[model samples]
Target: MSTAAVTDKRHSTLRAASLPRWTPWVIAAGSLVLGIGISMAAGLDSQVQWGLIAAVLFVLGTFGVAARVEGRRQAKDRVATSLVWVAFLLAVVPLVSLIWVTVVRGVKVLDVYFLTHSMGVVADTEPGGGIYHAIIGSLEQVGLATLIGAPIGVLTAIYLVEYGRGRLAKAVTFFVDVMTGIPSIVAGLFILSLMLIFEMQPFGFAGSLALAILMMPVVVRSTEEMLKLVPNELREASLALGVPKWRTILKVVLPTSVGGITTGIMLAVARIAGETAPVLLLVFGNPFINNNPFEGAQASLPLYIYQQFANSAGSGAAFDRAWAASLTLIAFVMILNLVARGIARWKAPKTGR
Candidate 1:
């Protein structure tokens, strides 16, 4: 035989057979049908069980077919890929279901009228109330908490990362770790106890303080991580140029990590926005519009939703309003996240190699 022909035959013989891309999709569809059929035969009612069975069947089918056509190594690789996809679906399915249900139920009563008006005189059993007051209170309280928490968090993180030493840094870090795990209710109770001592009435700013407490630890952790990611070379270069340590941090270190710090601040804001315990204990959930957060009781979205559901007993109007309020809170957090992402992208350091 000619050398060229021999080489071609050898290469062709060594090449392993691979499955078509559509093979997985076909197997998935078959697995789904078979899983449903088996569930029906077993008289099972759970959709979750059907999904689990389908996922198992899909992975098994991929392994079996690939092992038969290709080698066991290729089969194992395909199985791993199938398992990853299954796990991803398992995680995402529940989130999509929740958002889908919220949208379906919330759209019934969420509109311009709902957004513009307040609960006012409408009873929980009645259908005419809105979340205007709740929106205002949530905004003010969360904004105030952000104002209180963000600067302190950034400064603490800067101290820990840049100038930390000896027992002081360890103590500060230990406290931050403890604070991160502190329950939202505990923070609320702490503030509530202080309010009692000072004879302070429940007001919007009181809730803000509790929220700020919850926010600070998260900001500290996130900011610390971000600051650590900044290369030491940059700091050394700045110091070599005769820049003071504080000035180097303010001008270079902060600007380099500003994107991440801003994102952390926004995440902390979102974390506190939906808290009902502190607001319930402090703000007291006002029904009427209270534009001044520092002076009066306020109605946050969470408190409004909780009140509606708790007081309604079985009222459909109250349930609808609760769902609508939940949707609004979800939207607010989502907007904060989107804004954070935008700011992070905008402020991210440019790279030119």
Candidate 2:
């Protein structure tokens, strides 16, 4: 090669034709407009149909335009990205819509007064009632279930992770797997059968037992995973220091994975918090306040909502109460999730590079 040609080649940069950074947004807007026009022209009234058309058009347009400009390889990558965005919007739009609708309908009856009073002496067909009793029942029942389930679950997980061996361990693992898939209604029925055998009446404690059954497998699975995340090096170090196995687990392993374990327990609590069938089959749904969970029927938010909606005689008041109770339950679950996130972040082991 000549010296001038070699120098020119070293200094030159290869460039390919590519779309602008804003090309996707422009394509999406155009597709949306075209989708709406097509839907209207075809006399289709479904917004979902319009959205599907827009998503399809956007993906097709991106692939075609990118292939023409940037080549087929880049076009396929763009198509994958487009597909991801479409799936994300598909998931998010319905969730946003649900929360929006719930908030709008819930605020009609949700107030401080609603949170403070019971439905004592109030007809389900009337407008004057509150979820105060339900709140009390839910708190007590879930608290009891947690107290019952969390420790046993954690201990079982510890056994599985640290000391599991032989056929016993296999049996425990098998049962945990089986329990994880047991329906809430089956738990309720099992408890119900015991109550019948003992000639007992519906009470809040019975509901708590069912919730505990539904809660344990989730706790066990999550806690087992968290315990496994604790590095073997930590356990080995403690053992090398002449520490007892139980003490080492308590001091080193448990502390290291405490955040994840706590998060799992909180999530388990949230899962059992919204259960209606167990509460219905056991607690029997009270209309008035019942503070003692052991002795009598009690109300829960889920049961309250179900009762109000199912029993109302074309009454707007009952429907409003159901929505308000739903809002409260959602708020409670959201708070638990937020708290779990906070605890996880705060107690998570700090990493150093």
Candidate 3:
């Protein structure tokens, strides 16, 4: 081939057609306008219908335009990208709507006074009480459950990852899997059966026992995964230094994975914090404040929300209290997640000097 012809071919290959950065925005605007026009012409009243139409139009328009301007390959890529964006928006919509509704309704009743007092003598319809008792019950129950569940779970995970070698290990693994799938209500019922046999009445400690059951499997699974992620070379190096297996695990392995373990524990705590069925079957939901978890029925936020909503009977005040409690519970869960993240970041192992 001639030198000029070779240069022309190389330049042509390098100068492939490219779309402008603003093309997606232009396509999206056109799709929205077209969708709105079609909705109006069809007399559609639902915003959801309009949004779906716009999403469909956006995907179709991007494919068609890219095919014409670029190529079939580019068109398919654009279509896939558009579909992913649409899916993300669809997933985000319900969460945004839920948070918005909660904030609007909850602020009507959430106040310092509402948080500091208890529903001692007030009627649900009248709604001049607070969730202090419920808050105390939740903290104590979750704290106690964590104390009981986390250690056992960590030790089980350590055994499974480090020393598991026989039928005993397989049996433990099978049972952990079984426990993972056990429903919260079933756990509560199991505890309830024990209580019945022992002639024990509903109390906060009973609820903690049920929550601990729910928490243990989660902790075991999370901690096991974290331990497995630690490099085997570290264990070998420790053994070469004449370190005991237990000392190696306690001094090196545990510190390296402590951040992940803490995160998992927080997640487990959040999972149990909002449980209503177990609390209902065990704690029994008291309206008045009771600090002792060992003896008397105690209130929890989830149970309080349920009771308030159930007793509302179309009463606005009662409904307001329910919404406020729901908001508080959500905030508590969110705070736990944030704290977990913070701890994970803070305790994460340093890789280099």
Candidate 4:
């Protein structure tokens, strides 16, 4: 308030700002030098030693400089923030590397022909064989799995959410949790055994059934979560209006939860698309294109990858094809996720006064 007091406050603030910003830089550099010295003194391997030395030195130097200029508290905060960024970079590097590798390797082998032919006639000597048959089989088997799994999963979820209570709901939940952790091989074995018992023979249909079992628990859990998130107020309002419980569920609840349900289904599909054990055991890959899943053996991308990599003659081509198939699978999942997001956005409740 007084002139002298105001002047004193301004001077104090100016004095506080006078410390050199380069203090932290100097400290970091000194720490780095010390780290290098320690690494050298210990006679550590060049790569590991140098890397550790650099990292330690950088961290120490950062703290030293920050503490000198910004005080201990601010310096710790700065170091923590920098460390977090470094951690994030570390996590992201692998994902970026994987995508880069997949795209680079996959594009080299991808072509129109690759999408249309099976490996049946293509010799390892030739370079132009396609994955057409494999693609079709993947679609058919996965499609059938969707058909089989979606209904049972949706119904189970509906029951759990709408009618299940106490012991029954808890049992379903526990079993679903258990099923979620079941080995993929076990599902294949179960289906294979069942087929053998029924004298149904191993085929693409059997693979579908196995995949369906694997997918159902995932779908049920996801759908149940989504359904539970639906506002109870909406259901109550519908019932208050004299809507039958089933009609209210059909007209309001289902519509409200449809977006999440679609997303869940897509997730389930994506989860099982690359499954190898079931298809390998049940469908058994064929060299020729087999559009009829019920009738005979069908080749899936996973089995195709396996066959190619297993044979010495086709190893290189198969490896290339495997990477390409991986890329395709990733793309498929990405597209499904995008579509899920779109559907969720479109179906989101309209908000207005």
Candidates in order, TM-scores: namely 0.88, 0.91, 0.90, 0.80
Model 3: lDDT to the true structure: 0.91
- Across 72-100, the per-residue lDDT of candidate 3 in tens digits comes to 77678789999999999999989998999
Error of 3 at 101 (Å): 1.2
Per-residue accuracy of model 1 over 225-335 as CA lDDT, tens digit each: 989878889999999999999999999999899998999999899889988898889999988999999897889999999999998785599999998988989998999
Predicted candidate 2 versus true structure: per-residue lDDT over 94-202, tens digit per residue: 9998889889989999999999999999887789789999999999999999999999999999999999999999999999999999999999999999999999999
**Model 4 segments more than 4 A misplaced:** 1-61, 67-79, 198-200, 312-315, 349-353
Between prediction 1 and prediction 3, which has the larger TM-score? 3
Model 4, TM vs. native: 0.80
Worst 10 residues of 1 by lDDT: 1-10
Deviation of model 3 at 336, angstroms? 1.0
TM-score, cand. 2: 0.91
Itemize residue pairs with steric clashes in candidate 3: none
Better of 2 and 3 by TM-score: 2
lDDT of 4 by residue, 1-353 (tens): 11232245333432232235665456556765777778778877665456556656666667776666546665676688557645665587679889999899889898877777678777654666777888898899999999999999999999999889899899998999899998989999998888889887667888998999999999999899888888889999999999999999899889999988998898889889889888999999888888899988888888877776676353577678777777777788778878877887777655443
Clashes of 1: 0
Q: What is the lDDT of residue 12 in candidate 3?
A: 46
- Candidate 2: where are CA atoms >4 Å away? 1-17, 313-315, 350-353
The lDDT-based order of candidates, best leading, equals 2, 3, 1, 4
